[model samples]
Target: FTRQGQSCTAASRIYVHASLIDAFVAALREAISKLKIGDPLDEATDIGTVISQRQKAKIESYIDLGARTAGAKVDRCGELPGAAHLKDGLFLQPTIITGVPEDSPLMREEIFGPVVCVQPWDDEDDVIARANDSDFGLAATVWTNDLRSALRTVQRLDAGYVQVNQNLTIQPNLSYGGFRKSGLGKEASLEAMLEHFTKKKTVVIDMR
Candidate 1:
């Protein structure tokens, strides 16, 4: 759902093992390269215009920063696809950045665009720590075939919503919310309904 990565559930940061990092990144680049960037009305368009010019500029800056940062490599998804009417509109090519540091701006802040940062991790402890280092814990996704590893990692994540061996998805029956600075309160479930309608009562006794 890279509506140019504007969605809150977008997988912005990916931590991959050294053995499979190259393959994963290659696959992502290949997939991104084929995206059809053009007018929203076009049925062939996989990517449409950004919300505004300011957002486009911000996303571009992050891409540039990712390229300049040490230990970070930025790969743009080549030229924009055929978009006859989108020439003057705010359209940015899909980008994939690898070797990103945990503290890099691209990794630290929400890009809210079609830019994803890839980092390699050798240790599970380190990866979990890096994942939780974020101030925003909206959601997290753990992709692993091993059940033990998936459960362990999911338990350690500070995110309010978590998915194991799957991409971020919101079902109607699930409560949607975030931890830390992401947001407060809940929405879209029975829990949210109770939270909104139920009230607590306190009684004091003067027996003292």
Candidate 2:
């Protein structure tokens, strides 16, 4: 739940290979459950309040829909903190929903909250297709030791940035942007600066 999943780069949808789904989910659940949810200003906080009450409510509704409408098994890993001062805080329990359908709304939309939906796939080609099926192709990540597969997946996935064996990281001096509806132009690097700052003028002289 990094930054309470307010980041657009957050891995809200995880398409795990079928063989590793059980192990991955178990590990994720354990890790999420152990995170410290408290005052964001506190140095000890791992998960914090999202942004506001409205966002909290929207996220909570998505979590509920993941279970009620999508038939996914929702696991709310922990409790909201009990500090009296934080009683009214817009904090949400880090949630993981598994066994969700590929086409589930929770899987498709950008929840932009501390919620993740997981679906399993058995075929590499199929998984690649499913991962690229989204309209928002901001960024994607592939975690595997197989270099060939990683490279292939990276090329096939329709995302502006594709990380191999890494998540939520950007290279220095590189252009950062999104594909499809996630974004239009780059954000960093010289390319972005040129795109916005420089104008092109074509002057043609015809010599008869």
| Model 2 bad stretches (over 4 Å) | 196-198, 203-208
Off by over 4 Å in 1: 196-198, 201-208
**Alpha-carbon RMSD, candidate 1:** 3.1
Write the residue-wise lDDT of candidate 1 on 58-148 in tens digits: 9999999987887778888956755465569788888889886677888889889988888888999988999999989988998888999
Candidate 1's displacement at residue 195, Å, is 1.9
The TM-score that candidate 1 achieves is 0.91
* Residue pairs whose backbone atoms clash in candidate 2: none
**Which candidate leads the pack in TM-score?**
2
lDDT of 2 at 130: 89
Would you estimate the TM-scores of all the predictions? 0.91, 0.93
Which digits, one per residue and each the tens of the lDDT, describe model 2 over residues 21-136? 99999999998999988999999999889888888888988888877964569999876899899998888889999877777778888899989987889998888888999989
Q: What lDDT score is found at residue 117 in candidate 2?
A: 85
